[model samples]
Target: MVLYKNEPLTGHPCSRPMARECVATLPASYFSDPKVFNLELQAIWSREWIYACHENRLRMTSPLEMTLATFPISLCLSESGSVAGSLNALTGKPDSRRIHTHVLNGFVFVNFSDAPPPFESTHVGLADEFKSVEHVFTEAEFDFWGHLSLPGAFNWKVFSDNYNECYHCPTSHPQFSKVYKIPSYVVDAREGYFVHSVEERQEGGKAAAASNASVTELLLTESNESFPMEAKRLYDESYSALNQKIKEYAKANPPRARAKAHEGGLFVHVFPNVGINVFGDFVTTLRWNPASHEKTLLQLEVFVRKGVSEAEMLRFSNFLKWVEIEDYVLCEATQKNLALGVYQVGVLHPFRENGLVHSQAQIRKRLVEYVSQERELKEKVGKQRDSSTTLSEESGTLLN
Candidate 1:
């Protein structure tokens, strides 16, 4: 489907088109229909290079067994310490076919197809962006903190739709709104991915200071009045112990600050299912694991500098989880509404939700192709059957 945007004619600033063009989202059936989900698995999931994990997770002693888009895969360390993956059958045994695996910037990607598209060419925009900020993701400079997997009762596309735009961020993510300048946030869609960039609110800015004060006040009240006497004592002692550990850890490992391109945040969303979030002191990988049409597992893996304190990391994790939960609620509600017969389609803001527009366009293109292929296959089979019937009739007539 071709979509057009309203634009001013060249050299005629006042000649703006009067017609308002709006991009419509995919039909609601795409979200909850099992048949559409199966088509996506065959066309999009199987052909795309799905992000698996960081190389650090792989060990020579034991292979990592996990499911990617419901396909079981086992990743192992090769003799040269590189990543290798194998597709497993229903019996939990490796099949003769080997899954195609590629490692880029220490992150592993797997494709279930026999002949997958060239990674760099297929993901030109993502590759270029990663190359530009290559210094920030050097494997040796960071440690894998851990991973968080949150299951949701929504389609993977719902999460992708939520991630593709920040229009709802201000109202949906209050804490996040204070930390980042929402007005300046931008999501630029490229060839095969989307880039999200935003500047942080100034450290001493009124908004930042107010947010910090509120958080401090909340923590103090919770620790002091909300807990029982014994619990309060335990909390106080734990806080002190954690502070000491932070100090000791900081002393042992001084901060190794790396130069960044700018004092802003950067995120890349590779089409189908991967996100790379880059921050000042840490990086995270986000994946949407689709189990069914209405189920998805959101996975987040954190990698931080060695000098980051345990307390700080914990706080960051908590904040991330909070934001994710807020999003989950919204997505789940949206999913439920979509499943209802009341709504079949919705309009998208051409500029604000352009990322979502791009994503849906990609999906629509793939499904269209799948439908075309199915039609051709049926036609071919029908022709062969007709030919076989004609030959049998001719043989029987000649014998009579």
Candidate 2:
């Protein structure tokens, strides 16, 4: 439920002092109010690291179009490999702001704030961590496929909530639950990013293979070979080449970071709106691009180690598409309810919904700071007005 008007936000849900209490979800207005959404765009989204396009999208002669809080931006590379950004809204005008850029493992991340926290400090160890698992996506071993963009009728946070935790997966996504061992799921929450992972059930690979075969057979039957096979075949060949390269590298080297023998999957959620899912066979990305208070664009990208079969590739794509559909349906319904004003707020399950608590708390915290800044600005203006009035009065007296 929403907090009482007189109640103080003196404690955080993550803190021991407030851990036992029925912590309230963020207010309905945070997800439903246009004014609140605009403030979030200015405060949170503008300052956080946003997943821009992959590095391969840019070229020395061409620029990749981007947006920050709906303001158009562009990123281009020069012949010497230097990257530059053009903020269209401030283009050709006297400006002190420059977009910040960080390229990690070929994924381009941008921040719009004049001074975002230093990339290395805010994202400490992540670059090295991802690099440790670079076999799956190192430029020499993997190639970028195409991307999928789907529009949904819901606040971006709705889908984010769905993705953050999988307590609902067993009931909502049976197939996904079958492959992902929900009980072994662990979360490592950090200052700027969160890593939530699940051990892959031993039986999952076989089950997933069966599912893929069925999907592929059905698709082939339905299309009667009309499905675009040429492009898929090309991808398969590229994957095969990648597989050989991986084998050679593995023979020459061992895993840099050794862990107990476990076939687990890992996913990292970067603050604000990007998720990276690393599975056994492929790496997938989900980016939530805010369209409005009630709309978000879901961008999905799948990358596989170079040597995957055509049927398997198709299967993975189909599976992801199905997953996206399921998520969007629930997110849209949740958004409708959130907008109905029928519920003010609800309580979050301390252990299961900790991600929601942290994320919403971050949102509320930034908003409160913005409000404080606004109040201070107003007070300064008021003082200036009084000071000017006093100066004019003294001048009149002296003249008289």
Candidate 3:
């Protein structure tokens, strides 16, 4: 499928599905095209929320805040409740909109939102720190030889598009697929999702309160209350606590694990940058290095309870590392393939690819709104969540 930015499906700067038939049928050569890669860059990753880092990166008061492939975007964690991230102003494109936040990712970057600094600065020379860090743009750090490309190759979306579904899981990732089911066109995701929620954390207070009686946890739909509370409130009651309820239900009615191995934790990929995957007892971060168009790197960090044994934690850590190796290998291969051709277009799966589809839709809509002459897409892009899965609901409580 040769994809052009201003073509019919894209309708000048974007295109969409039903045109997706070519996605599966197109050979590897199609996706390898440089022109197609460029089009994908313009349409996808540019404006979408690409997860760069989590709160942990900026921990130390005078620590090096690195952006994978790019140079370090010096982070100053001062005693005062202000975080000043310094970049190499010379290389940074002044006009570029520093990705203050990946609006689509939904979690407002602490930089933009009201997430105040937990600690304070006990130092001086704030301007000097900004002077030292080399920034391509405030969004991306400068790296003479790193992964972040000003127009990162093919855009990280290619990796994300690949991750959203398991259509290729039966073939590509056999090990993990053996333990948990992957949703394809024919199968429903209720089971895969069911397995995790069953094991996930119960809220702060209630669990096993009533083994069999009726309980209902209603999440009142409210917006922008604070971090953690999220959009819905899961006030557990007599009917069911949807988050932990999935676990109790799954256990009583165990969803068949493709195999007996449920070693890993939940990994609900939040597009553009952040992905949360569970491995045993830890939640891992899958971060990408955006140096340039030719290369990108991804890193994983796992967090677990304070008192857990290291050996126990390593069990899932090793497993996730192996799984990540699979993804990284694929991403590298895809990059190689994309670097070769000029017109390959990938299609989004209507089922397993809610994130990909939502991302593309938002991207197309945004491109039409921001770059189009006709101003055909002026509609605002509210935070997009794949309502099909219980992630938003789960994360709403957990993050809060």
Candidate 4:
């Protein structure tokens, strides 16, 4: 089932039970309409568990600050290490909005809704998957170096669609393609979020750890050796310095075998917003917030084990900046094209674009549920009004 350019997919965007083909590209209005955006803001953004920041920020500062659904919320870490999030106000009494907080694996998550699902239940088996990094996460030994915020002219979902899949890496990111086995990348759509993994495929169809090399190993091996001499020299210099740090880290804290065999590094997309990308040695977090129908504010932060060397930290920061810049360019261009009105929808690769597919499905599902609730409330209200009118008319007739 294919849809032509500018042709509408059958059924309303807010309709329940959308066919797979119709969901390939969301209606352009989903990205542009203010009303639809507000519906999503209330339905999905305000209710779901949003990935905010790491606990390290709380350690460095009393109240970790952030914005959610246009509200300026300040999160404070109590003496008990329990996080309390509150909305700020300038005058009058404090706002009465409830801010729910949940901390998992040293990562801070908050929900604007009064209640959200338990983190463990929502995430399914993610805790077991992170058992290998218990020392880094559970011990709170990771340091939050800094964050880079990139504002671009694209809907936040557009950037999400780009980040969730690696299908375009071969043509779009030559440097990334060199290190990552794009064909082997896959996303596991959990109940509330998606987990991505990359692994080399074996002859028997079983997944292996990139031929026994983890992400860090591949980074140290493939990237430095495959690039041109100029790039190679820079990498060699960087590695020569970073190798000392690695040796010290290993000597102090010997590497432990991962509890679970998830093959490559893990990248998690926690519905609607937070993106946590974990490499073996370091982790990069991405926060997506919508500024307008056509604009989004993205914050990218890199974190490493508490005592990582400055040289090694700089390498990860530089790599993130370069790759994210590439993504910004692509997303910005795509946003412009989307606004041109020449193309309203486009087909997605059935196998490769499943991440985008799952995300869109989640979005549509929430919208449908919201719409259904609204409809039911409206009908109930109408019935109450009619009953009240009938009672008034009968009283008047009896009085006459």
Candidate 5:
């Protein structure tokens, strides 16, 4: 009689120790409490390096005016062609206060703090990683395709919590799951950011071959009559013109080899509100703009290679929109539940939800420090008040 031995199942290395521990998520108050949100605005959003825009958007003639975490900022190009930032006062004048600005691989970042932490030290590994792929960001290699703004009626943290983990991708994003392998997805927490790695689904030894062939066939065989009229009306250029541009671009510049990576796609979420999604043929950035404690505007900026077709771009955009809508529904529903005043805290799955755990830890650390300082100040003020009262009583007794 031959007996077979049972084999042990192994998971991703980063999740092994986390699987052994049960962690608690942040309290519901963190999501719905106005006081906590205000604290965060001072602690996290105002202090950290917030992604502003790509360098391509900055003009020599005029400065780009925008708001970061409700603080007005004007990004201008100096004589040396480097970016400079200025804080805008309530009266629409440029304040004397300095706004720290840093550009990494064509992506611009700004900090509202007076003395922000050193960008290199804060970013550490992330800056080095961006430098490695700096070639792809050059004007000769890729172009800024466009950007999309998606407004949501949920707290910014809710949206961030959703972005930090892929545990819900299988259930929440079916189309996205079909494109990437879910079980192999991993999110690694770095110094000041989180790295998400996922491999594309393969068929017959080729990455994304199935999806690519289907999309190519759809683009070739489909007639213009079936094109969505709404899309045509929304976009300034016609399908034919876009297709011609794609062909011309392809002829001018042949497709080059992409940067090497163990996984097919890599996504980096910097502290606060920046997400960089890096793929072979294209890249997209996700920026979260907090309009209020309960409202967030998500901006997606797409950059594509020289030869990517219009149909391919449209398909990718539609897929992203579908995923965004699904996440928006989830975040808004979660926010409503949080505001119900019933669920105070929840447990997290150590193995599948470690990314969320890391994000909450970062937030909790900042809020905890703020709370500590606030208590200390209150105690000091109370002591001073009591001393003054005692002194007044003694003075009255002496006068009597």
Candidate 6:
């Protein structure tokens, strides 16, 4: 059970468990090695349920399968009435760089996103008039898994790992803490989800402390009587009150962003390589596939872009984009520094980082399974060769 690779890195724990830390200690060469990464790519990704299309992606045709690079995909909904997609890894063919196409029954189908105008499901329609989904071949996703960053992202694991905890808000994310208060750290993953989990830590230990401190403050309130009323006074909050000047000072620094309803719903990573952000209007289905061990391909689709008011769309886009940027910068920073000669792999804040630990545990388990199977195959092959050699020697002896 090699939990933390022997290396060193620098990054504050994104969650509580104050002493817990992470050092991008996973070796850089591992990412450079195709073999190590491919193992993770195949066993963990292919066998898992990646985020395909969000619930609202298709008013017409829903996605059936989504694959990581080229494997059994569920991103394309291939229900009888829905469109089906296929990709074959051809080596010597004319268009051999991984072909992705749609077909119904045995006939090639058209992609609606690429249709010039009047886009409709192609059944018995003319092939000549249809244009290929050009993005399929040249999209940034092709490079998503091989580089440190992309046109639209830096590293995705930040989003996955960050969504797993909210422990840093009180200090690191002053802007964010104002709006949301978190207490619990473990991710109460959605039911039936095998890979990812969403954690909410609202109303934490600080709340209790606040309640206890209020008794003394209340007496001071009656005697000192000359109290200056402020926006978030000691007892201003609904349930608790605070006694210290430090807590008051901390609150004053940044007026917490007023929280609206959970219009921007929670996001969930579908293990291995897909993410889903369930917001107010619609959820987003984001796919990240390994372009290489260190890089990944990302796809973003808004499942419910329709029926949204312009205002809500703008707000959603702004918040989502900003949050992603914040996460990307951190993930990349960790990825880059992880290869340094001095960083050590650290533990997840078990309470807050359960999802991250779960993900790591899952990856480790799969690695063990796949490596074991490979070893078995090599042993079998070696035994066959030895048996064949013995048979040949026996034949020579018999003939002689």
Candidate 6 residues 372-400, lDDT tens each?
A: 66546657767654554432332332122
- Return the candidate ranking by TM-score, descending: 1, 5, 2, 4, 6, 3
lDDT string for model 4 (12-115, tens) is: 22112223453456766577655666667767787888877877778878787677656577888899978888766625866645488888777788887766
Off by over 4 Å in 3: 1-50, 61-63, 68-72, 80-87, 92-155, 183-266, 278-280, 373-400
TM agreement with the true structure for every prediction: 0.78, 0.76, 0.49, 0.73, 0.76, 0.52
Error of 4 at 66 (Å): 2.0
Best by lDDT: 1
Candidate 6 Cα deviation (angstroms), residue 134: 35
lDDT winner between candidates 3 and 5: 5
Which has the better TM-score: candidate 1, or candidate 3? 1
RMSD of each: 9.3, 10.2, 20.3, 11.1, 9.9, 18.9
**Each model's lDDT:** 0.70, 0.64, 0.37, 0.64, 0.68, 0.39
**Whole-structure CA lDDT of model 3:** 0.37
TM-score winner among the candidates?
1
Collision count of model 5: 0
Across residues 1-400, which tens digit of lDDT does each residue of candidate 2 receive?
2232232223322121113445788777678877667777766788777887666657423577755457688888778866667666566777534588888777778888888888778776567657756654465544455565666789888888788777777777766787778877655555666677677677775556534253432232234433235423433343344344434543444333223222234578877888987765667778998988898888766665555555555566656644555576678778989988998988886556656766777777876776566556657767554554432332332122
Q: lDDT score of model 2? A: 0.64
lDDT tens digits by residue: candidate 3, 46-117: 434344444343442354455533433544444662344543343656731222332111112212213322
Indicate the worst ten consecutive residues by lDDT in candidate 2: 9-18
Instruction: State the lDDT at 394 in candidate 1.
Output: 28
| Poorest stretch of ten by lDDT in candidate 1 | 10-19
| Steric clash pairs (candidate 4) | none
